[model samples]
Target: MSLELYYWDGLQGRGEFVRLALEEARADYVEVVRGKSSEGLGTAAMMALMKSRDEPYPPFAPPFLKDGDLVIAQTANILFYLSPRLNLAPSVESLRYVANGLQLTIADMVTEAHDTHHPLASGLNYEDQKDAAKLRAHDFIDHRIPKFMSYFERVLKQNPAGDTFMVGDALSYVDLSMFQLIDGLLYAFPRALKRFGEHYPRLAALHDAVLVRPNIAAYLESGRRIEHNEACVFRHYPELDKAAT
Candidate 1:
């Protein structure tokens, strides 16, 4: 497995989505940032790759996968590429697009979740825009969460193969991602989640099912699973969360 994954050293951020898929497959890959910098395969290498002009398809940021000569960036895109090869996607070619679309929708929800804390600007610290974040968070928890969570519930109900997974009969990368999304939502807005989780019973069930998977369960308990922090996406602030207040 000559796969090298480049993401931030300390935080899971978007890279964790890709990591979940790889972990589920038990794929041998190098998480560059987690390794020792002295080995010349660290965050610095990832940073250098981002600026490399020699590469044909230059990645704009971290959370990129380097598979032999092919370098792919973006969490959803990388998952779309790897899921099929790793046997983490639907066998049907057409359904692959549906899986990718769901992954992209998850990405949208992630962006909204991230902006809830850094509502004004990603360049600024959450403290700098606390007021805006409060407003953004209120709207996110009150409005956006329901919209997205309900949408996923519908997706699950209409899954054709039943709501066992996000896409097809087996667990795809999209399923792993939705589980991550639900986990993040619970962390960032536990109060809102508790109030609204029941309405999306199917989605909640999917989350529970994914959590118990042997590979996912092991990876989560293992040292590789980075805990949620204020610095990463889905920061939990007491004031920002409706239930906390």
Candidate 2:
């Protein structure tokens, strides 16, 4: 049976990470909440499932995958589970651990990216948190970006198999996640990313390479690829951008 991915109907959000892996692997799966519904199963449906008693393995949030009798949540954890099955992970135990470590790093960067606009509180509107957002955005541009980029660049440069992929010679889930990270950063912080790109040539190349992958290219061209917006994690507020500059 095909796997069932449950998440908000629109926007990539966290779900896109899992979706990208599935697409890259050419795995058969259905985007559950995105399917036809009278009321439309979006965030509400996702929330209900998380809180439902019927669910033996409730997710902490959206972007959970149900494969047969198993349910898995947490973006990195989902990737951890799917990576081996999809042959998008290293075979060696140490390399697999390294891949997951990189994934966690990506998660940290993503959270920081979201905080750039919602530093005060995610519940508050960007308009309401503009001052805090400015502070956070500046910090991110000045410190966080370089820090994360340096780490990933080191991983690539220090990899035993060379700089082609995150974990050794072959493409892995971490590479795809890194691709998404760079792509989202570029969208959310064009100027900052441009400046940051000069320091991490290999990372930029990986981002470009992932986009050229057949499945990823199709996903990008298709309506499935949601554009970054104010409602999502990586919001582009002019004030935040200006602060970064």
Candidate 3:
């Protein structure tokens, strides 16, 4: 059966991470909400499923996955569930947990990235929270970016197998997520990421490697890959970006 991925239409948002894995694995899946409304696979259908009382446990938001009879929510949880099935996870059981931990950490960074533009509140517009966002973005670019990215650099450098992949000897979902994370960061803060190659060489290399992977390259060139926009989690605001020292 084709996996049904439920996420908002237009923007990549948190759903892109899941989409990356699915694309990399060449998994048979359908973007439920992206489908035509005429076919009853649009946002209305997605909302109906969410509101359906027949479901034992409904997701709090979109970016959930429906695999066979199982409904999986939360980006991290969705990736964890799909990774093994997609052959994008480590064969070692213990390393799978490690990959999950890394993915969760990546999620944390993603939240921080979103908060940088909407520091005061998600309810408020970025223009309304511009002042606070500037402050938050400064701290994030100066401290958090280095902290989280440095840890990933260390993870790659210290990988038991090699620096090619995140959790194991081969490509894993964590590596795919890392690529998206770095790519998003670069889009949102090009100035801040200017020194990425110098400071986070391993991570930068990994990002480059993932970019050239045949499946990923094709997906990127295809119209299916949504461009980063203000509505997405990683928004580019010139005033909110600062170059690293």
For every candidate, C-alpha RMSD to the true structure in Å: 1.5, 1.9, 0.9
Local lDDT at 59 for model 1: 96
lDDT of 2: 0.85
lDDT of 3 by residue, 1-245 (tens): 89999999899899999999999999999999989989989999999989998888989898999988889999999998888889998999999899999999999999999999998889988899899999999999999999999999999999999998998899999999999999999999999999999999999999999999999999999999999998999999989898986
Off by over 4 Å in 3: none
TM-score per model over all chains: 0.96, 0.94, 0.98
Model 2, C-alpha of 154: deviation from truth (Å): 1.0
Tell me which residue pairs clash in candidate 3. none
Task: In model 3, state the lDDT of residue 107.
Answer: 98
Error of 1 at 112 (Å): 0.4
lDDT of 1 by residue, 1-245 (tens): 56899999777789999999999999999998878879978878888888887879899987899999899999999998898778998999999999998899999999999999988889998889999999999998778887888799999999899888988898899999999998988888888888555688888888899899999999999999999887778788988998522
Candidate 1, pairs of clashing residues? none
Q: Candidates' lDDT values, in order?
A: 0.88, 0.85, 0.94
Cα distance off (Å), candidate 3, residue 230: 0.9
Best candidate, lDDT: 3
